[model samples]
Structures are given as structure tokens and as C-alpha cells.
Target: MATQVNPPRGMRDFLPVEKRVRDRVLRVIRAAYEHHGFEEIETPVVEDAARLHAGLGGDNEKLAFAVMRRGLEVDDLRAAAAPLELADLGLRFDLTVPLARFIATHRSSLPPVFRAIQIAPVWRAERPQRGRYRQFMQCDIDIAGEPGITAELELLAATGDALTRLGIPDAFIRINDRRILFAALDHAGIAPELHEAALITVDKLDKIGPAGVAAELAERGVDGERLLATLEAIRAGESTGAGGTLHGFDAAALEPVRELLAANAGIRLEFDPTLVRGMGYYTGPIFEIAHPDLPFSIGGGGRYDGMVGRFLGRELPAVGISLGFERLVDLVSLPEEEAGETVALLVDKEVEPTRAIAIKRDLVAAGQTVRMQRRTKNVTALLEQLAASGATHFAFVRPGDTAATLEVKPID
Candidate 1:
């Protein structure tokens, strides 16, 4: 009996149609990033475990897919063992971390406010679900430089523009500042020490409703009154006044956010106090884009001013945003007819190699996916078989022809 083979859990193999959809999604993202003056860059999939550990904060430590040295044993004699002090690499958990490392190593060769777009796979050891996967591609855009809200707003606008262009309607770009959330927690009487844990709990308010969040808080040692007060404060922020004007509040900590929202009136921006992003490194404004009909967020990002500084010796203020390519594709319903045609190139065996190459190039140049025919005997029969295989366009190459021509023959 042969051993059964299968992809590991949480991993996926994309078929032709699926790859086409994914490629289309990436094309849109690449165009958007380039339009915004972001230069694309690639980094190694694996990095030193120490660097990955230091870059990603505490919670991510458990999620890292660490690699161990082969043939190393606990009982190996100290005299014969080579130093394994630097267990120098593991798969990157996210693109931003590696970008930070890249900047630090090549600081002299890069611009001051470096703008980069990275699209690559990131691995995690999390359980898979509908929108979540252990190995996934993250499309990231980050600007590193002077600390200001303009950079943040620009990224936000880019995200809105990209999704809107991708035909995703009814999507909301939810905005909130970590400082504001922290201040609200303070107002609600939650102790300073409990802020991180409380925010982590609050971040799940949407997924696990208010009741569920409150229960979670209690489990994490939050009492009923503080949780209720915090919830009420968040609700208050969601209301627009009778005159359709936003309610006034102290804007010192949220000044940057307020200005950006006021300027971008057309953006579907909303301020939700309960929007606590689940990353320990987010030191300032945090935002997430969500679709009303979708169960997961389409994209999200926040200011990580200290991340770059961790690798570099100096503070490199930076902000980045990542688009959930898979989730975005899932939300879009593309029309079948508008999709590109898949051409099956049926070539005669006696045809010179140059002719086959020429035909393939022409089809490709005309915006078609050309699949070379493998079998040559009974060409007509093969074409008939291919027609039933969902390929609509067929290119038949005879031994000698001045130019390729399409002959539509009625099937009997």
C-alpha cells in the first residue's frame, strides 16, 4: 500500500483558477503601491530567530515557526559540539519586521524617509479558519521618517482608494488611536497596569460581542463596573450629534487623527473607541478596514515608531498598512464572462519548434493564458476533448502557415 500524501494542516495549494484570482488581486495592489511612490522590495523568507523574536513583540513569540538544528542532541559531548549559540533563522512572521532589519543593515544606501512595498509569505503557527491561514501572503507598505499624521493619513487614503478601485463597496475604514483608547480606559477607572490586557480583551469586542468581551474581561480580572463604564464610553464616541456634527472631546492626544478625518470627508471613516488593535507594538493611531457583510477585516495597520529603532540604533518613526489579499479576493464577486480566456494551444508534432514558440508568444501577447497541447494524434478529437475541459479558446498550428487564423467549426 502506498502512503497517503497531503499538505500539512493550515497550508493550501492554489489551483489554476485560484492562482489567477490571487494574481489579479496582487496586480491591483502593486499598481496602487507604485502610484503612491513606494518601491517594491523583497526579503528572505527566513531570518535569525533572535531577530524575529526581538522584532515581533511578546504575543507573537508563540506564533513563530522556529527551526531547530538537525542532529543536535542533549547528550552530545561538550568537547565535540560546535557552538549553537546563535540559532540564526526562522521563517518571518510578517514583512514589517524584516523590512526594519533591512533598513538597519542598509541604512546608508537608502533614502531618509524610505517608502517600501513588500508582498511575501509570512508563516504562523495558528489554527486555520475561513479567513485565517498558517502560511499567508502579506502586502505591506511602510514609510519611515519624521513622526507625523500625514504619513498615517496618506496610507489610510491609499487603502481606501485601493479597495474602492477593487470594487469593494460598503467597506468602512474604522479609526482609533491607542492613546485615545488608553485615555478612555483611564476615564473608566481601569488601572494603568491592566491597560494592555484590557485592550487585548477590548479588541475582540466585535468578534465576540459586548457580552462576550465583558465575560473575557472578567476572566482576565476586570470587574463589572469598570468594564461597563468602558463599554459605555466607547458607545458615546460612536454617536453623531443632533445637528449631524461629531461630538467634541479633548483632542490633545487625538489631534492628528481629528485633523486627518476632518480633511478626508469622502473617506468612509469612523471613530470607534473600542477599536483596540491586538498588537503590543502599536504605540499610537490604529486603524482597521472592515466590510459589513464579511466576518473578517479586509486590512489593518498602525504606528510602530519603536519597531525600527529596535534593530537600528536610533528611533526611526514609521507606519505601515497591510492588505489581506485572500480576504479581499473572497469578498469580490467577479463576473465569469469578463474573466480572461484560457487558450489551449493544439500544435501538430511535425511543426517546427520555432512555429510553436511563435504561436505561444502571440497568444500570450494578446492577453491569454496559453497551455501547450501534449498529445498530437487525432488533433480534431483532442480539440473536441479540450472544448469539454472548460477552455474556450483553441489555437491550432499546422506545419506551415503565414499567420495564425481562428476557424470556428460547428460541432456535430
Candidate 2:
């Protein structure tokens, strides 16, 4: 029996065409960030297990992929208290944690206020589904050490530039603050101990309607009725709508939300008081990018003034945004690759190998993408394969024909 060849569950394998789109989109995003004065940086895919499991990751820590301690004996495995006990390192679930550590490690050499670009793949042990993967890429730009609301605004502007450059319209960002969320809890008389759990319940308000949330919260031995009523009023777009002053918001948190709405230009941003980002590290002013055509957010981030401090022992203001690469790639339709003509150089079997190499080399040097292939009897099938592999045109190299004399024809 032949062995089945496939990628591991929840992972994916991209063909040549798919990879071309992915690479092009990544370049577009990277170019946008750099144009906004953000410089790219890289970090390892793995981090210390202790750091990965810290409270900052929220629910993501449960889904992290742990790397077992090296050189573990059978005795070590048997005596372990839990699965994670045998693991010393883990694949990072998100870029923020690793970036926090990176800044802490290299802060002295970096600028006073650093704008870093991180475009990389992160791993999560998620149940495989459409637009959800165990491994995927995140395009993130973060500003650190800027304590003011400027960092949030800059992150939003940079992300908007990326989406606009990709030709996506109708995308808007919804802003909120963790402080406001807690303030709402305080106004409703919810205990501090139940705040986190209560917020988790509220986050699901969309999936399960008010009735469902009320039921669940009641089952949790709490009355969320008044909180849900206030949330419904907020969603009704009464006192707080786009580009309008917030009325019922907490007095201190009110001004920043107003600034985000009034100052946003490149994209439409609204105030979503109920927008509870899942990450536990967020301190203030959270926002998420949404499109009218999609039911879920395509990107989101917020201020985390204390994450770097987890490593540096002192909190520094940090704000960032990440575009969901896999989800957004489907919505983008870029023009076909136009940098250069992709040419397949077909040479006869009797043609000298050096001649083919010389022709391919010359074509490549002349700013054309050239792939050399031996001429086959099934020219139609060969041309089909080449075109599927991203060839735009083909040239037949005859025994006497030089590079200048070959006849070129479009594959289509």
C-alpha cells in the first residue's frame, strides 16, 4: 500500500498560485507599514513555556503547542504531574508575547518610541475549519513607549493604509476600552471577582442573544439582566453613534473614544462599547476592524501598557493591530503578477544543455522570469502545466535558433 501524503491536521499546503497571492499581499502590507515609518523585525517561533502560560494570553494559553523538554527519560515522563510538566518550551500562540520579550531584551538599543513591524506565522492547536488553522500568518505593526492615545491612532492609520492598498473598501474599525467595560460592571454593581467571567459572558452576546446570555449568567449565579439592557441600548446606536460625542460613557474614558472617532480619516471608525477583545493584556482603547460583508472582525488590537513590563519589570505603553491574513486573503483580488513576464523556455531533447542554460540565464538577466523545460511530445499538457505554475508565455528553442531568434508565443 502507498503511504498517504498530506500535511498534518489543521495545517495547510499552498500551491504555487496560492503562494503568489500570499506573498504579494504580504509585500503590500509590509510596504504600507514601512511607508508609515514602521521598521520590520523578526523573533523566534518559540518561547519559554513559563512565558507562554502567563496570564496575559487569556484563553490562547490553553491552545498553545508545548515543546517537550529535551532528553527526557521514560522515568521523567512517568513521574510528570501533567502534560505540560514535561515541556520546557512552547510555540508562541501570538506575536504580542514574543514582541514584548523582544522589546524587553533590546530596549536599550531601540529608539525611545519604537515602531516595529512583525509579519510572521503563529501556531495554535485549534480545531481545523474554514478560515481557521492550527498555523497561520499575522501581519502586525505595533508602537511601544508612547503613553498617549497617539499610539492607538497610528496603529489604526497604518492598518487602514494596508487594507486600502490591498483594494478593500467598506472596512471600518470599532473602538472601546477595557476601562469602560469595567466601569459598566461597576455601575451595574457586579462584584470585582466576577468581572472577568461576566465579561466573557458578554463577549458571547452576539452568538447567543440577550436571552441566552441572561440564562448563562443566571446559571453562573449572577444577574446580568441590567447589564444586558444597557448593552442593548448602546447597540441601538442612541446616545453613542459614529462621529458623535459619547453620552453615557465613563467620564475619564469618554474623551479618548471621542478622539478616535473624530480623528480617524483613512477608514471609518465607530465606537463599540461592547467590543471586548479576548486578550487579557489589554489596558485601554481596544478596537476591531469589521466589514459590512463579513460577520466577524478581520483584525483587532489595543493598548497593553503592562505586557513588556512583565519582562522589563516596568510597564511601557504599547498598542498594535493585526490583520487576519488567511481570512482577508480570500476577500482580496489583486491584479495578476505584472512585475515581469513569466516565460517557459522549451528546448528540444537534442539541444545542448549549455544552450538551454544560456538562454534561460539571458532571459532571467533581461528581467523576465524564465523556467527551462525539455520539449515533450505532449506539448498541450506541458503548456497547461506551465501556465498553471504561473507562466505567462513560452518560447521554443530550436537546434539552430539562438536566444534572439527563438519564437515566443503566449500560453493562453
lDDT of 1: 0.75
Question: Which tens-of-lDDT digit does each residue in 191-245 have in candidate 2?
Answer: 8999889888988977997788889888876688977765555546435453222
Alpha-carbon deviation at 105 in model 2, angstroms: 0.4
What lDDT score belongs to each candidate, Candidate 1 first?
Answer: 0.75, 0.86
Candidate 1: where are CA atoms >4 Å away? 74-87, 234-251, 334-370, 376-412
Tell me, by TM-score, which candidate is best.
Answer: 2
Q: Residues 1-412, candidate 1: write the lDDT tens digits.
A: 9885768888889877678678778888788778878899999998888887773655766688877656656654354443434245788888878998898998899988888899989999888886778999988998888588778877876777777768875788788788777666666667889888888878777687878878987887776356556545544644543211223323365666666667773358877667777778887888888888876788888898998888899999989889887788877764443645667776777888898788788767877677778657676787777666546676666777423564423333
RMSD of 2: 2.6
Error of 1 at 196 (Å): 1.4
Over the full model, what C-alpha lDDT does candidate 2 score relative to the true structure?
Answer: 0.86
TM-score to true structure, per model: 0.82, 0.93
**Per-residue lDDT value at 28 in model 2:** 90
Clashing pairs in 2: none
